[model samples]
Target: MTEHLGTDGKNHLQRLASLRRPLAAIALCCSVAVSLQGCVEMMVGGAVMGSLAATDRRTFGAQTEDKTIVFKGESRVSKLIGEAGHVNVNSFNRKVLLTGEVRDEAMKAAVEREINAIENVASVVNELEIAGVSSFSSRSNDTLITGKVKAAFVDAKDLFANSIKVVTERGNVYLMGLVTQTEGARAAEVTRNVGGVQKVIKVFDYITEDELRQLSTTQDKQTAR
Candidate 1:
């Protein structure tokens, strides 16, 4: 039997093929980690986190603060919008991105206000749509799409996959990162072609090429320590 796909389906399959190797590598690593002894597993986990932290553009304090912001912001949002909407909070370097759905415009604005009021939140990008909450299946699909985008990023040689934060809301991909203009654009370009990505939104804090060079140098020095 022969099956012919439409243009969109063919493109989607091509994109998925490109991501297979990297995603498989990730799966292999996870499996290996699971087979390790507890002490070895802990050490492996610590080393992985340390490597990510070393390469991260944010300062250690900023990284810590971002995690804090996400936790507190999500908690606050949950309390305020209880049963009114579905919200996901992602904070990178104190800037928060709000994605998902709300009951109405007022709820959307209120969510933003609540997120903005969180301690150490520098700014908020409110991308909440005024609609009924998304279903579990839709959210699961978004998660799968997000994973595919991230795997595609990992497969791209020119981009630092860890540098870009990917968030998906109803098939819309939002990229948050501290990257140079060229890097941000390249990241978006790569993301736009990925399977299941309906749109790519760049929510980036841009730096100069010189600044990027400095960051790379700093990361190398930290990693060599």
Candidate 2:
């Protein structure tokens, strides 16, 4: 009877051990499922964040910036001028470019002083001519010239057309860009050829050929690494 009891005890222990193995397996499976769910949630959250960031990033080119602020600034600039003077306000990315003719140096200084006080202005490029009031014909012709220059930049094969910003006021063409010297010069030449352009002023941040090559090399190395 004792030997029979020992056999029964062994059988019970073996059954308990078998049950523990299945239970352990089930626990492991549950853990894996929870881990996978967490990973999926993290991935979905990242995708949503990435989409939102992309949507928020500003797109360059043909962006008609809100002219209300610019117009208001222009009006304020005009108010600062003498009766004989004119103020031209051209705003891009919050940087205000002031160009036109004022009656005297005082008027010019006052115009700049007034514009400097305006809110949201990043910086001011005061290129106002003090002596001469620009003729209507001259201004009209400058407009035509600007259109032509813009057309040329847009048609260029080697340059990024949208990256070049053309601002013309009173026969002076202001060129803004993040480009190589060669590209900037080419763009300037194109502007010069446009009819009635009195002068071309460069406000470019130039990227040299060697630096551009180095930048390209670095990018390639990063990609390879």
Candidate 3:
């Protein structure tokens, strides 16, 4: 049976289209994943993330550039830090967030510089701590905290959950999105209350509600045409 893809207004078809080039790679990985549960989990997670990316307000081109920025940034960080630090690189709409811990101020500065050098990186937020690297247990707990915040946002129902990206490091939660001021505040408020979060930081691109409405209308018109 042949599977046919169609647009359903919420970008489902777009996500499937974006997966075309990777279908071959994904097929190859299916065999390997059968032997490794971790590999299967990674593949499923990446696919889910890619599906979400297609629904992002940023242009598909911008989404691709954001992924490129993270990949290039991580490659450079590995060369710079090796076993000296633990850093997580996240790029949302081309704005890169640097989290985790480096050994010293010098290393933190170096990480920022290396990331800024990545093409299409509009800005870099260096939230990396200058202290001993986090333990594996700590990092794992941070990941759980991030998931909790995202799930909370979905349950809130007042905001488009996909509009925000959450990153957690050492219990600090960072939120990134292109949202209205009201939306940003609401998101921050909800995230701050999520269990295990130590702090909340908002890195949002604010626009008036009218502007957001106009953008949505324009997109609908474009899609209709």
> What is the TM-score of each predicted model, taking all chains together?
0.82, 0.58, 0.75
Tell me the whole-model lDDT of each prediction, alpha carbons only: 0.90, 0.73, 0.86
Local error of candidate 3 at 152, Å?
A: 0.7
Give the higher-lDDT candidate: 2 or 3: 3
lDDT by residue (tens digit), candidate 2, 88-189: 787655567778888888887888778777766667888888777778887887778778887887677766665676878877899875578898888888
Write down the TM-score for model 2. 0.58
Worst 10 residues of 1 by lDDT: 1-10
lDDT per residue (tens digit) for residues 46-76 in model 3 = 9897667544667778778988888888899
State the lDDT at 178 in candidate 3.
Answer: 78
Worst 10 residues of 2 by lDDT: 55-64
Please give the distance, in angstroms, between residue 35's alpha carbon in candidate 3 and its true position after superposition: 22
Q: Lowest-lDDT window of 10 residues in candidate 3?
A: 1-10
Screening candidate 3 with a backbone cut-off below 3 angstroms (N, C-alpha, C), the clashing residue pairs are: none
lDDT tens per residue, model 1, 8-59: 8888888998899899999999988777767797899999999888777998
